[model samples]
Target chain A: MTGKAHCYKRDHINTDEIIPARYLNMDREADLAQHAMEDIDPEFVKKINQGDFIIAGEDFGCGSSREHAVWALRGAGVRAVIADTFARIFYRNCVNNGFLAIECPGISQQVDSGDELEIDIEKGIIKNRTKGDQYTFQPITGFAREVIGAGGLLNYIAGKVV
Target chain B: MGATITEKILAAHCGRTQVNPGELINAEIDVIMCHDVTTTPAIDMLTDRGLSRVAHPERVVVIPDHFVPNKDIKSAEMVAKIRRWAKEQGIDKFYELGRHGVCHALLPEQGYVRPGITIVCGDSHTCTHGALGAFSTGIGSTDLAATLATGKLWFKVPETILFRLNGKLGKGVYAKDVILEIIRQIGVDGALYKAMEFTGELIDELSVEARMTICNMAIEAGGKSGIINPDQKTINYVEAHTAEPFKIFKSDSDAEYCRIVEINVTDLEPLVAFPHLPSNGKPVWQVGEIPVDQAYIGSCTNGRIEDLRVAAEILKNRQVAKNTRMIVVPATTNIWKQANQEGLLDIFMAAGAAVSTPTCGACLGGHMGILAAGERCISSTNRNFIGRMGSPQSEVYLASPATVAASAVAGKIADPRNYM
Candidate 1:
């Protein structure tokens, strides 16, 4: 996957900032997309495009188990999220929702905002197109990768169950 | 090799004799908790997939406490939708508003949680069940939907980090302070993807309510779950609530741990987590006299009967400060009834504090006593993140119920030792 980076340089960017609690009442995915990252960056929606990536520091999605955080980001055409680490539940939600989340050590320092990057899930390499830098990260392995490859856990399970 | 409590429980649920850390296994879930906030999305996902009928309706427990009393019309409609779906599915454990309280608190009180079982809930505070020795953790709605369709989910056996707390707690130094100190020592992600098994004499001496409070905030440290081996106190508490059969498991004395953290509580004072992060903790004495506009005492974290008693003891005859508004909420309807029976509610009402019904009101900035812009609140609830209690510009200080009550009386962040 190749995309432009939308960098959020801080650590522990909790779900409350990714998508605030007030918008949780909206059941539709499209309605949630409009408010993605509104709390942390009001102009985030305007800056994002299809297949863009979110670069964050450690413990991304640290608060709340609301899947709206994933839904909103996915709805806003986010291809994947690259962070130093992610909260356990949020990491699982990303896999189940087929929203890819990559754990790259010192990723925030390597990629600048608007820097173009290419991610090869199978190769486990992230190449920075703007800075001409290359970094290697551990790709999603084992059953988790299979789930994401099938587009989601439900789809993966459906294939196995039938 | 001897297994930790969490490993044993997960192995048992997986129909295996033994399991190791990092091994993936499919485990049967003993209970599944779904709240109103996540139910609509889960149901929508299930419908979109053309799947009808939940796999095991009997194993699913539904509670509508997050936005109960419906903060707005949309929230009301969501609750009604949950009611209709739960009723149609014949999920007898579904507790409507006014019947149940926060799902995390209500589960243990209603005997739905027990030791040596694997449980999953759609809320992060599900780790609170680990206080009873259950292997519980939170999952998102998609995972909840998967669990609803099949009474099983995959789990990675997490490595254990033993936290050995020693010494005795001083006056006004509660379990909240101990956990906050631990979080302060280890940054927010210190125990990422690991089980935090609390041990030692101090933890054994803590009440089940205090244990729950400690386990409830384990997520704040990025733990998969916080657990304590089931003891007589746990068994007795579970037995008093229900006659359901349960298993008990304990980690071997010589079991290996990825890391062991030693914490001493003898000199620990009441601690408060400053704004923006739970990891940003300091002793109450060092926080100075920061004025507060509101003081809240409730949430699944510290809204139990014992917590209410602590608050009532501090607010007995004195009224809350004129500049401060105090909101006290009991965790469960049963807790509310017991507090009223014991006259704790009368003491709070007489102290000029507004006592609310059993709900997670204002804890997640849901409703009821939300702070306005630039306002500051001292809360007994977990998580003091920015915009957690209301406006983004508002601030919150996290403390114990006793500290919250004392601060309410002083209109500032005050130490509970003076009032005690």
Candidate 2:
């Protein structure tokens, strides 16, 4: 997947900032998309096109176990999130939701906003097209690879049960 | 390679002789906790997939917190859907309005949580159950739905980080202060993807309720769970609640630990975490006079009866400041009843504090006591993240319930020691 980067160089971009608690009451795709990242960046949704990626520092998606944050990002045309690290639950949420969360340590320092990123899922390599840089993330292996491969836990479980 | 308490519990659940950190295993769940916000989504996902069967109705407990009492039309519908699903599944442990409370508190109060069990919930604070020596952690909706259908979930055996806390706690220092100080010492994410095993003289001396407070915020330090080996206090507490059978798992003295931290608690003052992060904790004396508009006490973190008693001790004769409003929410209906019988409610209301039925609202900025822009609240609940309590411009300072009461009386952040 290829997308432009929305680089946020600070750490701890919590789920609350991604989607505030007030919007938690409404889970519709449109409603969540309408207010995604309103707490941190008011123009986040308007500024990104479909298939764009978010670049963040450490502890990205910290605080709150709300999966609505994932829905809000997906709804707002976020294709994936590349962070130095992620809060544990948020990382699993991405895997279970079939959303991409690439952990590229120090990736925040290497890229600027609006830079182009192309990810090769098979090789676990992220190429910075604009800067001609390459960073490697932990290749998804074992059961996790299969879960995402099967398009999330629900479908994976359905297949296993059947 | 001896196993820690967490490993012992997970190994038992997965039918293995032993398991190591970083290994993945599919473990059978002994308890599944469901609440309104996330359970509604899990239910919808299940129904959408034609997989609406509960693997074990008897093992699930449904509690509608977060937006309990229906904060709005949307929340009311979510609760209704959960009610319909619970009824259809024949899950008798569903605690409807008036009977419901925070899942972490209500589950233990009713004796669903016990030592040496694997527990899963859709809320982040499910780690709160680890206080009783259970291997509990939070999951997102997809995992919740899968667990609900199969009574099993996947887990990566987390490395254990041993925290040895020793020394006597001075007057006015509570478990909440201890956890806050620890979080400050270890920046957030210090223990990422690890099980925090707390032991030593201080943990042995603490009451079960106090221990719960200490274990509740393990996530703030990026721990998958926080646990203490079951002791006499744990056994007595469980025996008082129910006769259900439970196992006791203890870590071997030679267990492998990824890291170890030692904390000395002597003369430690009460603490308050400043805005933006739980790791931004400061000793109450070090914090300047920051005025607060709201003082809230409740959540899975510190909403137990003992927490209410601590706040009541400071608010017995004092009044909430003119500009500051106080809200006290007992974590469970049983706790609410116990507080009322003990006259804690009367003391709170007479002191101009509003008493609420159990709800996680306001703590997560859901409802009941949300703050306005430019407002600050001194809360006993965990996490002071940005926009956690209301408007993004609002600030939440996290402190002990006693400290919250004292601050409410002073109309700014104040030490609880002075009031005592």
Candidate 3:
């Protein structure tokens, strides 16, 4: 995955902020995408284009089990989210949806907003193209890889259940 | 080494004799809960994938609590889809508007949960069932879809943390305060991907309602689940609700735990979590007169009958201050009726507070009590994330129902002990 990095040097970007619960009335991924990050950053929807990356600090997506956070980010054309750490449910949601959420320690310091990033998900390597810095992340492995290969849990379930 | 209760339960559900943390396993889902906000999305995904039928409809419980009574056009449409699907699927456990309540509280109250089993829900507080010694946890929309289609889902067995809570709580302190203190010690992600097993003296003395409140916020600490061993109290509660047969499991004396924490709640005061994080808790005395705009007591956490009793005890004969308003929401239909029977509703109304039927409204900012920019509320709900209760500038302070009642009477952050 390669994209322009939109780094937010803060931690605990909860699901409530990623996609506020008020907009949860509309579960259509497309509708939720319009309000993504509306609570934390009003300019988030306006600033980023397709194939952009969200670079964040520790404990990103900390509260709530709403998968709308992943849906909204993916729908907004975000390629991936690189955080220092992740709340477990959010990480699971991303893997289940086949959306990339990379956990790379010190990622927030290495990549600045507008920097370019090229991620080798298979190898768990992140190349900061703008800064010429490189970092490693916990690689997706085993069953999680298989689920992602099948394009999310639903497809995986469909293929298996049938 | 012996396995913890969480491990033993997961191992049993997956048909394994032993399993360790981080090992992946596919477990049979014993019970699943569906609510309005999350269920509709699951239905959409399943229908799109052409797997539109429930594999085990009998095991599924449908309750539309989040936007029930239809908050708006979109919410109404969302719930309409859930209602239609539940009928078409023939889910016998469906609870509609008049009978509906918060998902977490309703599950246990209806006897769908028991010891030594697994419970799944799309709502995070599904962990609330863990108070009954069930290995309950929350899943996302796609996960809900997959579980519905297959009756099974994969899990990465979680490490278990033993929290030995000792000492009797001080005046005005509650299970909510104990949990807040735990979260304060271990930040938001302290138990990431782990199971929190709360045990020892305090849990033994605590009522199931308070235990549910503690387990409900397990998600706030990033836990996979929060659990306790089923004792006589659990069996009694379960029997009172249903005649269903249930197996029981306990952690072996030599059970393995990844970590152990010793908490002494002897003189702990009423606690409150400030804006933006549940882990940002401090003693209410230190909060010093932060004016409250709204004091809310509801949600799966503290909307139980016991919680209502506590709030009513404090709010009795006390009028809500002119500067703030209080909203009391009993968690389930039964809880509401019980509170009404006990005259708690009358006290709230006579005390100049608003009482409503059970809904997760205002807690998630869906509707009913949204705050304007810069407004603040003291809530008995679990979270305090930014804009969690309303506008981005509106802050939410999380406290026990007792503290919320006291703060509502005082119109600011005040010590509940004074009322006690």
Instruction: Give per-residue lDDT, candidate 1, residue B91.
Output: 91
Report residue B133 deviation for candidate 2 (angstroms): 1.0
DockQ of each: 0.78, 0.84, 0.85
TM-score of each: 0.99, 0.99, 0.99
lDDT of 1 by residue, B108-164 (tens): 999998898888988888889999999999889988988888899999999999999
Alpha carbon lDDT of residue A66, candidate 2?
85
What ordering of candidates by DockQ runs from best to worst?
3, 2, 1
Q: Model 1 reproduces what portion of true contacts?
A: 0.65
lDDT of 1 at B166: 94
User: What i-RMS does every model get?
Assistant: 1.0, 0.8, 0.8
Q: Interface RMSD computed for candidate 3 is what?
A: 0.8
Deviation from truth (RMSD, Å), model 3: 0.9
What RMSD, rounded to one decimal, does every model reach? 1.0, 1.0, 0.9
Chain A in model 2: its TM-score?
0.97
| Quality class of the docking in candidate 2, CAPRI style | high
Candidate 1 backbone collisions, by pair:
none
Off by over 4 Å in 2: none
**lDDT by residue for model 2 over B1-420, one digit each (tens)?**
688999999999999999999999999999999998888889988999999899999899999988988999999999998899999999988899989898888998999889999999998888888889999998888899999999999999999999999999998899999999988998888888899989999999999988888888998998899999999999999989889999999999899999999999997899999988998888898898799999999988899989999999999998999999999999999999999999999999999999999999999999999989999999999889889999999999999998999999999999999999
